[model samples]
Target: MEINLNKHISGQFNVELEQIRNDVLKMGGLVEQQLTNALNAVNNFDHDLAKQVLENDIHVNKMEVKIDEACTRIIAKRQPAASDLRLVLAIIKTITDLERIGDEAERIARVALESFNKAQQEFLVSMDNMGRKATTMLHDVLDAFARMDVDAAFEVHQSDKALDKEYEGITRQLMTYMMEDPRSIPKVMDVLWSVRSLERIGDRCQNISEYIIYFVKGKDVRHTSEDDIKENVL
Candidate 1:
């Protein structure tokens, strides 16, 4: 949304770049919707919604392949340099994370299919919290990437800690529920897997945020410390 269009001198190359960016954003929207639908399916135990999530996955996969090919072609023909090169490379990384997030969502949807009838609304507090956090993180990261806003990206990165804590608490709660009532073990396991998928989605969002910083700063921060990231990222 905040792309600097003035950097381009060639109209044709600019159009190609915009096309790839548009495709990437469109793919992001699909994954975001898939994640939301998957969470709702688990929250309400809606098999229909779960099925829809699965059905929509083909589009996400297709978008990834389509965007990847476009990026490759742009690199080959445009020979983008410096920051433009970074933009193309960052898109490649972002799409990979988005696709993985989609997989996690699909996995959660499958859990819904397995345990929709087993859902205990009262016991879903932690899961709901985590799901909302993941959804917000995903949305925020996309906005940050679009705007190239380092501060916004860092905000999402910081929120990942709270999401991780929520997942741990959910694990503990589910474990206790199982121990207290062995009869509930099967149901608890189903919810556990769903929580695991949600946590993984949060992780993928964090990875995307890290990539936002990496391309902005022109340095890899994957293995860097948080303090270092703060110091290094613009």
Candidate 2:
């Protein structure tokens, strides 16, 4: 995860770049923990754990603001060009995705406060599985960002398709559950929304992985197919 940012002529500029990079990683770390805690809270039905995740979200938001300000200052004063400029831009976009991911985690934590009947609880097992996968994707993408590993990022980008497939399967299962037991529709909808949050978190992780590739290769891979992204990365 150690990146060499010592290539700049101005040591102070190098330090500034490195500082913002470190801050982004810090923000990413917090977001990762938030997702993990939120998933655990839902699976265990821990109201206190869920409440703690909501409280800690402000810290994630603050980190995004702080790092964003640092990037603006760099752009205003340093006027970084080429790779340096790309790095700053990527950090800006990455933090935005991370913050949104935090918001999704908050949303999932809120589901922990809701009540579900024993029959409705079975669906949560599927949601928990999806949440764990989404959490892993987030962690891997953050690792790729820390190392600036384009290959790792590419792998993470590819992983999202499988997550999407899982989301579809779970949604179908929930729909069938509601059709069979109309009375459970309300509680099932809450679980449905929570799973949707998990799916969105996977999308956010994929976006972050794309940012990693964009920084290293200066290629905009968004809205591109897997074959196209593979060509760009390779």
Candidate 3:
């Protein structure tokens, strides 16, 4: 009889845990769409779409607040230990990352709406490519978290290095363009800001991937070597 009672309690906790996880995934879906819209706005040069992205930031902010409250309640009531605790901690951390990514997306949208002459339009092509890569990474990272796949998360970490290279190359090209045409400096500066925001979005996605890995393996892999993360996961 006692064994059955313990099992029932465990099952109940599992249900509650799954609910929280599902909510997190739902929030992730919203964030993913927000990023897509922001990138599209930039690529298409649509101020209306940019405004829409800015408006959605409010919804993302509300999700973060709700998720945090739910996590706190679960911790207080369930007193979850070990792996369960790690899951809650991970969701809390990831929500904060998602919120910040939304902020960066809004910033990108603002810069993207600026009027660009011919040369500036040409430079924006590189920015569009960079935005695509970062958005793709965010999509993959969220999928990895939903599936609780540490290997997938590791892939996201490695993918961020590509974004870093892209950012550096674009920034160098922009610097040369400014030197050649001083009149283009203002547009160049806006592109620089947008690229910086996109790069940071990639970084925040990487951080969320790390949290996913930590949730699955019970190991905090931040500041650890790539070899170490691979060894731990695989």
Off by over 4 Å in 3: 1-11
Give the TM-score (vs. native) of candidate 3: 0.93
lDDT of 1 by residue, 117-234 (tens): 3345546556787899999999999988888787898888888889889999899998998888797787778778889888888888888888887777778778777787888665
Candidate lDDT values, in order: 0.85, 0.90, 0.86
| Regions more than 4 Å wrong, model 2 | none
Backbone clashes under 3 angstroms, per model: 0, 0, 0
Model 2 weakest 10-residue run by lDDT: 1-10
| Tens digit of per-residue lDDT, candidate 2, span 1-234 | 568664877889988888899899899999999999998998999999999999999999999999999999999998889888889999999999999999999999998999877877797899877887898899999999999999999999999988999999999999998999899898889888988998998899999998888888889888999898886555
Candidate 1 lowest-lDDT run of ten: 115-124
Runs of candidate 1 exceeding 4 Å displacement: 5-9, 115-125
Q: Is candidate 1 or candidate 3 better by lDDT?
A: 3
| TM per candidate | 0.93, 0.97, 0.93
lDDT by residue (60-131, candidate 3, tens digit) is 999999989989998998888877789899999999999998898888888767998776798788888898
